[model samples]
Target chain A: MAQTNLLSPPSTISPPTALQLSQKAPRIIANPPTSSLPWPLSLLFSAETPEAWVTHENALYACLRTHDDAAARQLLDRLSARFGESNERIITLRGIYEEATAKNNGELEVVFKKYEDILKQDPTNFGVRKRRVAVLKSLGRTSDAITALTMLVESSPTDLEAWAELGEMYAKVGEWARAIWCAEEVLLVMPNSWSAHAHLATLHYLSTQSSPHLAPLNLSLKNFARSIELNDSYLRGYYGLKLVCQKLIPLLSESSSVSKRNQDEDGPPPNLETVKKLEELATSKLAEIVRRYQPGTKEWQGYDGAEVIAARELLNRDANTER
Target chain B: MTLLQTAPKKQTLAQIRQQRSLVRGINLRTNANTLSPSSFQARKAYMVSAYQEGKFLADPEGRGKPRPNPMSDPAAMEGMMGMMKGNMAMMVPQTLIMGWINAFFSGFVIMKLPFPLTPQFKSMLQSGVGTRDLDVRWVSSLSWYFLTLFGLQPVYNFILGSNNAANQVTQQMGQVNPGAGLMGPEQDPDKLFLNEAENLEVLEHRWILDGVEDRLLARTAG
Candidate 1:
């Protein structure tokens, strides 16, 4: 799996049973045809499992997914009865229920308006604001969604989650510099996070690739090295560092061979020797990571499946280049 | 400040939960408010003095020594509890619940139910219909009273906010633990004031716009 995953990456690993059960709509509602036993009876049996409420909650969405209108309605009724119909979560769930039942996107607009009305009544409602954002995104009004998200982050600056979301939105719009800025904000709050450092590095690498003349190359190399220094096992950090070094070694040579490029305080202008040494360091470290956490092992599974796969691909490409 | 508005969003379920926690973090009393240099220093002065005053009231000795605080006395504690229970929350619902409690025990059945149920139920769940010839489906007035008592919470929340009178579950939990809330009546104002004072004293304001001009100039030059 590791060897072949070089050029073509594998999809997300099937979540372990406990996670899958929590994430998926429960089968009880999703597959009424397959289950011979009645839902209440199934509930009675599973009541002791401590996962019943989660199952029931997921079952509500499951029913919607399967288009089991009756089951979905029943689940919603049960939920609303437990937590009053006017409850914010219940209200949003009702909107979601309607959205699911809507035949077309046009019908979903009415549900969207309902959420807007709810927000207009209580503007501070984070729950409603979140629902409104989702509705806007689903409706393909990316700009409107961005507006709402910007407000959310404004009121809640410490929210790393919102920071990440705003970052992704910028990335989607090809606003690479903006995305990098968002990453830096999160990095400011979470200074010691190796992954956050690596993530910022990735953003810099991407921005430079997209617009080399505009992006800050110095931060790109520094951050990736920082990530690796923070957590040597971080495969993505090493992978990104290698790529940045690969690009820099030639650029440094060209600039130096022509004329001494003006160096800034951020770092001595990436010289050929430093770039080559960093590239070698990245390659060896990546190779060690691949050898230690070969795919299909428990230890390997602990590493981000996608990052490991991508690193494998980079190594393979580098090997081919050498050949 | 400038670059933040243009960024990111997957807006997943976990992200929403995270946002809630982060938002909660800002409201903590220990946190210093975002302020300009002058405003921050002024607020710090105000906070320390206010805290000292509160702390002195709770402990007359202030930080010097301990004293027999009246708040800890049984009579004062009882009075505080009475005030909390007698708070505005009791005005409408308390009268209603009291009236119904009397009505149910008075042996006067106001109404019956439309549905059927088993016989051997608690009086709270059964009808208060005053008669021996009662059907099992007849709901006791006491039960109806409870139904309204617990049921109107969501209605209250809809009319108000979620934290308003509608959620008796939270209210009841709050009742179960009196001193759990910030600055509950039994608290030492002195300690609270001192904490706030210290928090304010150490509060350093970093202006977001500090290096804005330089940053923009560098960007333009580059």
Candidate 2:
């Protein structure tokens, strides 16, 4: 548990894990391995390691998630003291702390105003800019958040995080074409990212519902297959591959003529045999993942519990339809 | 050697920060203008042509060619100055030591080899000793000094780990052309961006999932 605590915090944490980490925060903050002796003695005696700072940072985030505001404040104070107030990262952390502790929309507005002030003084502070966008999003002004994000991406095109966020925002607002473009942009920057390919595949699959074309389904199938090829053990990739193959198998058989007409333009759609084989591959992979993940096995513990459960549900749904 | 080591380490840290800021600035300028749909389409056309031609077109404004001397850049200038200072520090001591050995210990036969040596080594092993008939195995003091000069590398490696900048020979060679690795001063940022764009365009997406069904079946059966 102590070893895990020093690692960087994951983007999303389950409520139970969040609570457990938050419960440990006060102890971590109180007994930081820093020495209190004078400079010379402290340098010689302190048991401080770089991991202690990482643990503190993770503890701070966990405390914020669990609404342990006091513990979060203590960790924030220690961090600011160690890495002065003017440090860019500390400034962003302070903004996050203020955003968390604010009880009302008006207070959030105050925090938002503070972030804007910081940006005005130094427009290059991308960390604070991201925080300001987060504030805009939380205030139920998603369109405004999207505009801000668009400008942010315009300035820093290489920021994969900003591009991914822009994609999510476009998806949230039902701008499927723009969302797909953003996902493609991510792939252009980081072509080997399995998650980016899966995201694009999901977007293609979702868009096909509105415009029932075999082209989008074919595109989705190719992307999902690409994602699975990139990461053999990727649960999300296999799940998406399975879903796309299931949809394409029936479509390919029924609309053989339609597929032939578009073959020259979109490349040939996978034959029924290939589609069936891909479906079987996805099914076997998903089953293996679900079996190994259910017991919280040591090697499989890295997979998120929620994702594994969702994969299990998908497998069960497939079985029921077959029956 | 310690003096030589300190200069490069400090300059490298500063160079990294400088490079990051330079890259971020370039990214902002290039991305800000080309993100619109029409411009993006234009870039795609350019990329496709560049891919077919197997080379990106040079900047029409003549910005990418005939790179200026890297010494003109203030950071490179500073690094070169630091290197010169380190080289001078090293040279002074080496020259003084050579002069002292030549003056005080020139003709002294310092040591002898345990094993026999051929007469061919007499000139090499008895440099400052002005005796043509001297035993080939007897090393002059000047020769001994030269030997220790080159042979102390392993001692330095033992004292400070392998990566220490204590090897005089390698350091002199490195100083001949500073900042010659990736992100070298001579590289034009625009050309690098274009080259990367071309690479991305030419990259073929071969799906690895083609025969995964057979592999899966085989695994299960085995």
Chain B vs. true chain B: TM-score for each candidate? 0.38, 0.60
Off by over 4 Å in 1: A1-74, A213-215, A256-274, A289-295, A303-307, B1-83, B86-222
DockQ of candidate 2 is 0.10
Candidate 2: residue pairs that collide? none
Backbone N/Cα/C clashes per model: 18, 0
> Model 1, A48-126: lDDT tens per residue?
3324444566656555555766767877876687568877778877887888887877887888888888877766566
B1-222 in candidate 1: lDDT tens per residue? 121111111233333333332332223222232222333354456536645554224235445445347677775676455446435454666788668687547555556667766667545566555565677666666666767876776666544444443343365566543223544445544455565556556656553322322332244236
lDDT of 2 by residue, B47-119 (tens): 4464344232233354446876776868678767766665675578779999999999989997889999899
DockQ of each: 0.04, 0.10
lDDT (C-alpha) at residue B29 in model 1: 23
